[model samples]
Target: MPEAPEADLAGFVRAHDPDRFLCTLFAPAAARPALFALTAFNHELARAREAASNPIAAQIRLQWWRDAVEEAAAGRPARRHEVATPLATAIGAGLLDPAALLAMIEAREAETEEDGLETEQDFVAWLRGTSGGWSAAAGRALGADPEAAEVLRALGAAYGLAGVLRSVPAHAARGRCLLPRDRLAATGLSAESVVATPHAPTVGALAAEMAAEGLEALRGARRDIPRGAVAAALPAVLAARDLMRLAAGREVPAPRGIGDRLAVTLAGLRGRV
Candidate 1:
């Protein structure tokens, strides 16, 4: 038999976002499915561009999601896709906000542009819109008031920064880099040079610098996350771990192993990062 919606969402989230998935396990049982739905929805939005064959195709997929979110927000039945079905249920239950999800979809449109991030402002905006928005929505779903949820957005952006720092070599291998041109130039690096010598000392140095910046931002944000809402914000621990690795010139973010799981669990229990 096909999986039930709750089971399907659980499996989807566990497969696509193990960090959030593990954190979701710390949530109350009644909230798990909705949280899973939110994670799944974000995953779909994230893949909208890359999953498509062309720019136009990516736009079409994003548009479809926009409409689906609007329909769900309006109390109408959403389009019958796997992610949409569960997401609509969560939105209908008032556990997730359509506007936040819409903003995330809009942010992704930038990825389709041939020219990547040009300025530091653009890079910062992308991080805020993508990861920051996601955390805000997920935070609210876990019962945080709007004020606290908004503050938690910075944690998500920190995670985004760490992700970019950790994936330097992977992105360089693809002949692309997520760092803004100005930042790269400031560090005496370029997309071409990064691609040519991904493991060079300069690349590691730049990654370390960027990771340190992200760690500082993350620490500032964590100080304000409400205790009750910390479970939803547990990804900050993983972000910190990744940022520390990048700062030490570790190319790839360390995967969650036994120790990592313990760290998140302890952080969740303590309501600290």
Candidate 2:
């Protein structure tokens, strides 16, 4: 039998994306590798812009991944990178689709071109393609019914927006802001002001508004997701938890503490991520 695709890929995900890594643990054993491979691929795409010194460099990195996906779809040899090799394995196993993977890469590429989101519509669209796409793919890998796709999409959008709101300080430091520009403008705040005074009352209010939007998406997801697809949607719980904290005037909470882990594990056991 072929050697198991490197465990290092899982290790990378566990280190960088602990929340998703935890969710993968609730997946069936046979599905864990594909889930890890998929999330790891997403981790790489999400970091591409920050990993580059300039937009051209970021585009080049994303293009390389695009080419790798195309080659894999065409039955070419897999690339030798930590993430790509396992991704190719997952694709070969028919656990993932090259088209969906390419769409995700394209979404990241679009993000690299924008300094900040210009409107609520733009933010929702971006979240749908990136995070929504990831959740949908996960549901597909788990053999969820076709009808559950839209539910996963809503969950992913809520989860993704909460993540973006939580990362405001880091994004601001990098001269990027993921908050909707028009909303900020209406409040007499701008991307620059957010970066300059992230802890100020105005910025806090903006964060609350964004968090409320995430909560709305989460409500929709809960209503529509079927029981079978709940495991795949577990990350949404983390999103909801964080958004609630933000709404309560707290800084975005950190990774799962002892009590937090217990809560998530209980939720997962009940098929309620």
Candidate 3:
């Protein structure tokens, strides 16, 4: 039976990140709690800026999580919070690395401070630092070999790019444009234009370019991902699905359904994602 705290953590992930929540179901039962906690911790950090009233408040909130990680690393008690407590448990179980978690938080902090991507390299680096770091940590938690780091990084980059592309409308609505400035400039579209006219021809072209890049990354990683580590890279499947939808000009955020779960399960069984 799942512990109360673990159940709460599972519930949190289910509500905030349904894809990851479903992915956890395929992981080893013993590792499910740790995965849930780790993903929920990600949700907390990713939303810090949006949840805060101001930049300073957001930094403070992120700092709290940083402190909690440090405390756990030092063998001290972590902060008493829903995510932190279970994260501490995962840390204690040797399923999570303190430095990796800290890197994720730092990446999110940088994102909160930056306005938009300046170059393709900048965007890639951001994705590697945030989503790559998260996927790598999940790989470690799933018992992936250290040498699999590169594969996990590639998968994370692909998955991260796809997610950002799918969220264009929502991000634009909030005055945030994730497209590289150079790409936007080449297409004669500004960050404002992306949010203001998301479906414009130029914006659509830029989205397609990004989707192509993401698909290439996904293909590159698929060739190298070990069968034993595929579960950790399950998000790559959803990333592919989303990228395909974007390429087809279909709606990106489809509701989670039995079909989605079965697709993920089949992908997992084949070690394809």
lDDT tens digits by residue: candidate 3, 96-134: 999989988987876666566788788888888787877
Error of 3 at 233 (Å): 1.0
Q: Candidate 2: where are CA atoms >4 Å away? A: 1-4, 222-228
Q: Which stretches of candidate 1 lie over 4 Å from their true place?
A: 1-4, 252-254
- Candidates' lDDT values, in order? 0.81, 0.81, 0.80
Candidate 3 similarity to native, TM-score = 0.92
List TM-score per model, in order: 0.92, 0.93, 0.92
Tens-digit lDDT string for candidate 1 (32-145): 888888888878877776588777898899998899899999999666777888888889999888888899899888766666788889998998888788788888888888
Q: Single out the weakest 10-residue window by summed lDDT for candidate 3.
A: 220-229
Q: Which ten residues in a row have the lowest lDDT in candidate 2?
A: 1-10
Backbone clash count for every predicted candidate, in the order shown: 0, 0, 0
